[model samples]
Target chain A: MKRLKPSLVFIFLVMPCSLLVAFTYYPAIKSLFSSFWNQGTSRRPSKFVGLENYQTLLADDVLAQILWNNALYALVTIPISIGLSIGMALLVNSKIKGTSLMRLSFFLPTMLPMIAVANIWLFFYAPGIGLISQIMQYFGFEPINFLGDASTSLWSMIVVAIWKESGLFMIFYLAALQAVPANLKEAAKIEGASGIQVFFDVVLPLLKPTTIFVAVNALINSFRLIDHVIVMTEGGPNNSSALLLYYIYEVTFAYRDFAYGSALTVFLVALLGLMALFQFKILDKKAHYQ
Target chain B: MKSTINRIAYSTLAISLATVWGFPFIYSLWAAFHEEKYSANFTWNAPLTLENFATVWAAAPFSLYFTNTVILTLIILASNLILCTLVAYAFARYKFPGAGLLFSFIMVQLLITPDILIVENYNTLAKIGLIDTIFGITLPYLTSAFGIFLLRQTFKTVPISLDEAAQVEGANTWRVLWDVYVPLAKPTYLAYALVSISFQWNNFLWPLIVTNSPEVRPITVGLSIFATVESGVEWALVNAATLLSTAPLVILFLIFQRRFVANFMRAGIK
Candidate 1:
């Protein structure tokens, strides 16, 4: 019985995590292995064509375009979402009336599922009768193809992502904002510091850690921005808005090219790993202002 | 005078931003209730009705979708809570070999989200013959690395004296964990629970890939059916379906509005 207790603990802890590792890590490593091969649609054994897949990926114009699209998507959405979230955090953190209600209203969209929210926006983006088009028409402009035009489709998706995520980010900033020392702001005020100056010198510096946190999170989210794309665009209108992950989905599921999909997945996992490492190393170094 | 102008500017910016953020939602609520043929035209003159809601409810088996989602989310939640707490306790308290490696391995899971792994994961599920099953849908997320990390941080804050006291009273390690550590980590548990529930509740892609039929589809997947070409771009019905799909989480947010915000803040992921 005495020996059984520790063994039970070992089993309890190790077993569940092993299941997780089997489902998560095993496939991850398998994906790495599968990336080197050409296992498209046959029941044949995967014969790895060493680095050929990588060479092909480099030369693939579609892959290159998707990567460019993803980079642009990340660049545009991350900054806007973080900026808007900080703005929201500041607004709700103010000693204003109805602050709680404002917070709730802002954060409410984050609660809705992305698919559901995308559906609403999909209708809003519908051609002539959509809300934005109607508004545009009212303002003496021709109706624009928001989702149909490749130029605006990605941006439209970004708008939805920003709307969904900014409020959640605001909550984090608000928490960090509350942790800022009240006396420091008062001291800055007494030293003839304007509100903008105080914010720039004291508040912004104090909020740096939270900024790093938000930035890393936003970067991760930007990479994971496939849900809405799948629902709304499906990387459509001539693959103009084809983010990397959605492209991967198309390669594997829609096209039934497992090996190529695995190659794309490898690139994505490596990209995410680099992002996580960069976030931890760079952000954590700058995060320790205290 | 400049300060007054700044205040007005900030307030104006804040209000306008809030409206921009809040308007689509209000529009959705309006569209959900009203039976307007064309949703693109905005007018405040339309009378609201519940007919669209009734139509959406009858058009699809949203009740089954809700049940599947609830059951799947609960399964993931219960498993994550138990497994995460145990693993976190081990990491926090034990001096075992490879503990750091294992914990870092868990952290790697965060980097490879389900979206990145969807293709290979789908293949894996197909191999195991678990595709189209609720267990398959919920299994991958049943053990959360974020939950483990969060709880480990919370557990480390617990004083060693409590464990020693429990030991002196002849209680086992499990008993110490349950009676001492768990109680002390209630807020952390609650925070983790809320986060886990929210993630699973709103999860789309995995369920989309795993389940093939309406019987196993969750609310998100079921609602997506309305957006497909067969549904023919009926904006009012789509909004109605979406509102119904999101009703549970929205209702929960409304009820525990304060705690929801507090829990999110405490979770601290910006």
Candidate 2:
């Protein structure tokens, strides 16, 4: 009967987690182990080189640039995306005309595949014949090669990231806005708080938990969402637009450098781990707020 | 009087912002309907044609890609539903040793994702001889952390009294779970399933790396490679292909936006 109980427990839990072991748990452990070794191909076994890959990654200029680009992507995309989300949510939440239309239009981008959207954006950012260039020509401004220039390429990707994230994140905020008690708002108004003051004093604090959730999503997406990079620029213009995940793709797949790619993956795992802790703190604050 | 003017200005600004958001798909739709020569510019008199879609269909094996995607999505959704329900039941009903640590470890996948482990996963898949197959593309995503989390939350809300009543009726643990928890969480399953379908349908990157042949490649990878290989000269065909891939989901969204919103809320995603 004791044996039967243990087996039942295993069947209940371990059997299910075992399915993920092949892809998630095992690969994570392997990535950790492989980062310490140099493995060239599937035929040969990896050699344990003791942090040689780490030294190479530290000195790698392209890795440094990719890291910077990712930080910039997160830094610029997070706040703007969150702000736009809140603003859009508030707009739709209001009893404005065509609110449903506006909400659907904003949310449409979330449904489209990033790869296909990147293809359309390619036309919008191309030189001369592109949509942006046509708009520029009408204003007598010089046509800019948005995707081809080293300076603007990264920014163009950032625009896509912002556009993609803002609409989806808006939905989360909209849900929270809808849940806020109408009586509370009316009470604040009765107390003579202006719209802005009421928003800051009542609505904002109520939306704090949702804000934390959306912020964490956007932060992680900024790091991992490199599909548009593959479609639009392929991290070109001298690697100016290369985010860390894209660099990991290029290194591991195109260059067949597994050790260094695993090193990059380790950095990504670390960043996400830090995010987990940050999220815990934020969540703890929410608990305290209650 | 000043307030009237301010209201008008706000309305105009909001409308323009909405227009900016919708402009890309609008352009794609216009180009998809027009002849290639007239598609390059806004010409009201341009002859509309269904020929671009036909051209796009013959230009790629999109039907095959569609089949592959559907099969891949089905396999993933089915496996996820079964596995996540069981695991979430264990999480909600049982108090096993080290279960807290295990749950936290599983939560790490919520942030890290198997995409980050692409390098090692590819190596592992190759060792198992699953490369270049639909199974290879779908394997990494089959066990979703989000699914388990969502279902666990739902299962916890199942009244424990009902579970105990079922146990008193001689139902075993498995029977209790199947009869009580699973039946109660059907709406949660529906909600989570839709979210999963929409995401896995449009998923790229890892699929692109794993599947090379036309037989196994999903539409996103297929469409992405088509754009790069054919270049920008055939915008009409490209737009038509894009429309083909996205139209179903957009229509689904339009019809079910309320359900989508409500389901997301019920999931308590935060």
The DockQ of each candidate is: 0.57, 0.57
Specify the highest-lDDT model's number. Answer: 2
Off by over 4 Å in 1: A1-9, A40-45, A287-290, B1-5, B267-270
Q: What is the TM-score of each candidate against the true structure?
A: 0.95, 0.95
lDDT of 1 by residue, A65-130 (tens): 888888888898888888888889999998666677678778988988898778888878887888
Off by over 4 Å in 2: A1-4, A41-46, A287-290, B1-6
Residue B89 of model 1: what lDDT?
A: 85
Model 2, global lDDT: 0.84
- lDDT for model 1, on a 0 to 1 scale? 0.82
TM-score, cand. 2: 0.95
Instruction: Please provide, for model 1 over B1-270, each residue's C-alpha lDDT reduced to its tens digit, 9 standing for 90 to 100.
Output: 987787788788777878888889988988888876636555678777898888878888889989999999999999998998888888888776566787888878776766568877898899989999999998788888888878888788788888888989999978988999999888778777777888888888778878898889988888787667435667788888888888888787678767766765654343
